[model samples]
Target: MSADDSVLLHTEGRAGYLTLNRPRALNALDHTMVRRIDEALTAWEHDPAVATVVLRGAGARGLCAGGDIRAIHRDASAGGGASSRAFWRDEYRLNDRIARYPKPYVALMDGIVMGGGVGLSAHAGVRIVTERSRIAMPETGIGFVPDVGGTFLLARAPGELGTHLALTGAAVGAADALLLGLADHFVPAARLSDLADGLAGAGVPETVARHAATAPGGELAAHREWIDSCYAADTVEEITERLADSGEQAAKEAAETLYTRSPTSLKVTLAALRRARALGSLEHALDQEYRIACAMLTSPDLVEGIRAQIIDKDRDPRWTPDRLAAVTAAEVARHFAPPAGPDLGLGAGGAAARDA
Candidate 1:
């Protein structure tokens, strides 16, 4: 149970483990940390001594909040700098590796898991959630579309829940996460230690499965009606209009949330979610996201959104479009255009035309 400073890389009996160690910022995935994780996983993949690989974050409050947005903001401010675009490429590659890793990957999703955290955990074979777990894809709130293969999982979610979450950045509790298929197992926080011990022992998978409790009833299932109806509309503007028309207190609150956000973000996000739904795999989704993300640094709304939210703490972002309805179809379409390059440096079958 002992931990180290940046990362705690150790072997607990037969299991190889890597724990994200920056608790204060909710273990946000920084560039260096992503490289370290990749290195550790690569080593573990071939290590005969390792029976299973478990990825977890330190502290009780969060597994990982997201990528270090402040860093990206700083890099973007430097004006198309060397490191800014490279970071996105490397991070996206890391996400792809995790999704295609060749082992039984277990993600201990104990607490708040957002953006980058979701990328790390969601694709794993076993995503274990506790009662305290609070998970979501909150990228749109920060003026970024959900990357980290978010499109793969969110697109696959039942009905319009994925689209709703991609747009609104809603947080779901453990029960809801289970019902939504975002998590595979639900275990109590108190039993996590015993479960980890079992995972490191002879009876690994069975032990973990035994400790898992079923998803609780209500909440997510009940709210599915409202979420589906509200998010089914064609555009963010249409969705907002529907929410406004509903007159329900929850719908009213949702409408307000949409109004307060950057219009460009909502537009880009909705388009990304729709495109991701049609994609075939995590690799495909990340590839599509890379094209959009490269263009994001040049967008006016991105810098302004980050400045207001993080740099200035103003909470007032003056998006370029000013209104969701004003974002033109051609503008949204620009994000998906292929980057000018000799090659995208992707793996097998990656160069083929994407479904969307």
Candidate 2:
């Protein structure tokens, strides 16, 4: 589909609708899609006729899988990092905008919403999930840290649940998402169409109330005791040790999952989550993520991870340092340094320095 067709836009009475339209790719977001969505929001923000905004994806599989990693893989492999950086600049800005949108932004997070998908929906004023919803920020598996204000959201989740999810790249169901504060309401998948239709004439609160139902019991709450205890450690190594000795099957599984991820990414992701907690604002967290994203462009793991997971489909990424012990503090610290170009500057002050 063309750029315009990638995101379908329309209006229904008082509601403006934005639908992610690339079903074949599970509506995986790209630079063009981000720009288009931002432009639509800008137009609707100023239009008095538009009282609310709604977002959804086109296909049955999911709202969005994540960013176009294949594209990033190609760019990083070719030593052309500028294009990917530009995409992140705009994408992060759009994420900040969603968090502060004036109009009631209602996100229909109905299916698999991972990585960039979480960024698009989790920050909205009203986030709705369903039985089909499987939400996560699974970036570490691809040797990347979560961007688009993901660290900000993850850092704020109760206890160390965020750390567990971040390290394991685990996809949670509706109830777990709600417990994590990543989503607001749970609506049955069968009633999502009705909920969308109701928004056309009714206010957001009433429309959502009509369909919202109690979410089924989640898995995380039961594991909170173990998760909080194991992930509370200061270092990933300590965390792993705690998990392995905790005797919880789930904690042990989480440790095994970490062993398969890029060691450098695990270390960086842990640092990012801790730093995001101190940053205390979505804009600041986004700015930090921008720097890390630019740094990843030059990291061999980003390219190799994507190659193994997506391009080559071998599922075996040979990380540069390969071991957690080998990823020095200096190496992890480098990702936090100012990028080569103009900083995203979203958190420098209250205003965005770079134009979106």
Q: Give me the candidate number with maximum TM-score.
A: 2
CA RMSD of all predictions: 3.3, 0.9
| Candidate 2 lDDT over residue span 1-356, tens digit each | 66799999999999999999999999999999999999999999999999999999998999999999888887888847988998999999999999989999999998999999999999999999999999988888889998888899999999999999998899999999999999999999999999998999999998899899999889999999999999999999999999999999998999999999999999999999999999979999999999999999989999989999999899998998888999999999999999999899998856636343
Model 2 ranges with Cα > 4 A deviation: 352-356
Task: Return the TM-score for each candidate structure.
Answer: 0.93, 0.99
Question: Which digits, one per residue and each the tens of the lDDT, describe model 1 over residues 1-356?
Answer: 23235677899788888889999889988888887888888889899888788888888787899888888887888756346567767777777777677787889899899988998898888889998889998766667788888877888888888887787788988888877778888888888878877888855569887788765553667667777898888888889998888867777788888887777778888888888877777777887887877777778777787788878998887878788778888888888887654223453345342211
Best by lDDT: 2
Q: Give the TM-score of candidate 1.
A: 0.93
Point out the worst 10-residue segment of candidate 2 by lDDT. Answer: 347-356
- Candidate 2, residue 182: how far the Cα is off, in Å: 0.3
Question: Candidate 1 — what's its lDDT?
Answer: 0.80
In order, the Cα lDDT scores of the candidates are 0.80, 0.93
**lDDT value, residue 167 of candidate 2:** 87
